[model samples]
Target: MSTGTIITGLRHRFRQLNEKPLRDDLIFYFAIIAVASVLFMALPLLTGEAAETDGMHRAWFIVAGTLIVLVQGLITGAVALLAVSLVEHFFLLFVDVHREFEKTMKSAVYALAPLILFSRAVLLGVSFAGLLLLAWFCLSTYFGVWIFHEKSKDRAVFVALATDAILAFYLHRWTVGPWLAL
Candidate 1:
């Protein structure tokens, strides 16, 4: 199919998901973020960072990590809204959803505006590593959705998550392990 068809289909799926309250979306986003958070926490341990040894520090770490994941979840929620809008507009050709492509794209760009905050955070901060990972993962997930709009969402998400896992594992072993002497 053409690129236009793919975009339209994604927009349709997005609208379908968004026909509910924000809370439902939040729940889904948070669950994904929490799983990702656990993975993030585990990474430090794999490198012998001792996050598990200090109970007090680990408690504080979890609190801070949870807040960061929550924020990342909020960002994903916003991106979902935009993707839904775009899918509706683009795919409306197949199953029209009362909106123009230009209008939808404009709205999507605005909806994705907050993602820039994440880039800024990555550039300026020395802390909140787990949050950074969550932000990057969310961004990657959305981009994967857009790129693989022709596939079932299950396949697309699986493709994206698998790619990320492999890349992260390799990078951890090749780059981080040597630095940390693990």
Candidate 2:
């Protein structure tokens, strides 16, 4: 999916997906993680903060750190995908919608388009727009779920929204809880 589709919503992305069943969604997911990791480091570098290390060359440290972040980001991202898809499926069960795991995965991965361009803004303390993107991300995922189960509009909305609420709460806690404590 192109960057332009992020603003168009999950329905458009799913249409593109249906047109191209062979597209590799994992690459999209990893690309988003990469973008996020770069944003995570961008502020520090821009602010002239140094990458302090114990006798390690600064360049080497940055390279090594980037590699570590990429790998760790992939692993963590995979776990999150699985967990979210599972939750999406569980929510579908309540509505008697038996969507496949891969469909839910499609919903999760394509919904990540919002994060690709905006998550860094949030992490960098751009609160208002980032919060909008965050809400968009949540809504898109639920919308994707509803799209997958087209037969039950009301039930789909309920299950999808409930699932999103649960996932969003846990995600905020895990991702921001430490900073909140400070």
Candidate 3:
């Protein structure tokens, strides 16, 4: 999608039930991961720890390190996306729901925008944009359940909290956390 579309997606949280569903194309999804991974790699430079890590000061080392971080972050992010989707779907199973897994995947997909677009600012100790982005992620994920599946607000909130907990406790370390620490 274009930059305008992405910005609009962020503003709308990418979960408008009145509109068409999220595109089922894997390429579009992975493209988000790729861009996020690139942005993630750049975040560590703010602290200079990325260059300091394993003597990455040299130009060649920087190039190689960037490629490695990009690949690792991409893989980890994809796996997290799948895992979170499954978890969210599993939670929804308690209700008399009959939605496809793609619905949950769509919810999880929108949550990434907050992290990928605004997380660096949070890590950098900037303004409150990060918190808003995070709220956007969680709130969108909650609303997405209502739009895509049952209208169980409680279950939706639980799914959102669970998703955020997983990110904070587990997936964060594998994906963007390392970059922030580097």
Superposition TM-score, candidate 1 onto the true structure: 0.32
**Weakest lDDT window of 10 consecutive positions for candidate 2:** 14-23
Ranking by TM-score: 2, 3, 1
Question: Which runs of model 2 end up more than 4 angstroms from their true locations?
Answer: 1-10, 52-56, 173-182
Question: lDDT tens digits, residues 83-144, model 1?
Answer: 54544344434432343344434333333334333333433333554344543553444443
Model 1 worst lDDT run, 10 consecutive residues: 106-115
Q: How accurate is candidate 2 locally (lDDT)?
A: 0.67
TM-score of each: 0.32, 0.76, 0.65
Candidate number achieving the greatest TM-score relative to the actual structure: 2
Tens digits of per-residue lDDT, candidate 3, 29-62, equal: 6777677777777667656866454444576776
lDDT, candidate 2, 1-182, per-residue tens:
88658646656666666444424777777788877776666557667785655455777877777778777877877787777778877877787765567777777776666655565665556536544655676677766776655535577567667766776687674445546867
Better of 1 and 2 by TM-score: 2
Against the reference, the lDDT scores of all candidates come to 0.48, 0.67, 0.67
Error of 1 at 160 (Å): 23
Model 3 quality (TM-score): 0.65
Runs in model 3 lying further than 4 Å from the true structure: 1-25, 43-57, 127-133, 150-155, 161-182
